[model samples]
Target: MGKVRGELRSHCPINFGIEIFGDRWTLLVLRDLLLQGKRRFGDFQASEEGISSNILAERLDRLTHYGLVTAERVAGDRRQIRYEPTEAGRALLPVLVEMAYWGARHDPRTAAPKSFALAYEADRAGLLRSVEAGTNPSEG
Candidate 1:
């Protein structure tokens, strides 16, 4: 689990996790970073979910506070900032993958691409490595 900034709701692992990322937008932001390689604020703004600037800002702030992400100004470009996931954030990849798998199995209208499911099942570790390296496995 990622580091908690404030007092946790309880000692239960599930409750601690929920307190950190239970919000609707937090997981989506993580998806963009982990899967889509989105780093810039504008990139997140362009996500299909259409998250507003205010909400995105808040989520990013919270993620940073929890040590899941690191935000830094781009080299030689103080006006532009990039956000990258820390190790704790990358550790959530398995959770997201499992959730996607569950959704694909249970939801008739699931949107997860079949290719991704196949690759995930074929080599889960390789897929995780590719994602952690900021590469889209489907593209490679």
Candidate 2:
């Protein structure tokens, strides 16, 4: 496991993972980057969850601090910033995928598309690769 940004609660891996990204907003930010191809601050704000600017800023900072994401100046535009997932961030794809799967199976109101669930079951590895490549697997 990668190093967490702050002091750990315990040696338990689950606890550590939760400490890193236990908040509801943190995973949403990761979802935007991993699944929605959202790279800008505004894009995240535009998400359906209606996240506040303060919370978005806090999550992005924490993700960056934990080495899950990187924020860089967009080329030719100093004022514009692009957020990209680091390798460590990309590594969370499987976790996210499994969570989606579980939610689809257990939650009747889950928005996970049937096509995505089927495609994921058919080619889990390929789907992960597509996601890591910044493409939506269900779209293809």
| TM-score (C-alpha) between model 2 and the true structure | 0.88
- In model 1, state the lDDT of residue 72: 95
Per-residue alpha-carbon lDDT of candidate 2 for residues 24-134, written as tens digits (9 for 90 to 100): 999999988987889999999999999998889888988998899999999899998899999999889889978877888789887888878887889988888877776
Tens digits of per-residue lDDT for model 1, 46-81: 998899998888889889998999999999999998
For each candidate in the order shown, give its overall lDDT on alpha carbons.
Answer: 0.84, 0.86
Give the Å error, residue 54, model 2.
Answer: 0.5
> TM-score of every model?
0.85, 0.88
Cα displacement (Å) at residue 118, model 1: 2.1
Model 2 poorest 10 in a row by lDDT = 1-10
Off by over 4 Å in 2: 1-5
Error of 1 at 87 (Å): 0.9
**What lDDT would candidate 1 get against the real structure?**
0.84
In candidate 1, list every pair of residues with a backbone clash. none
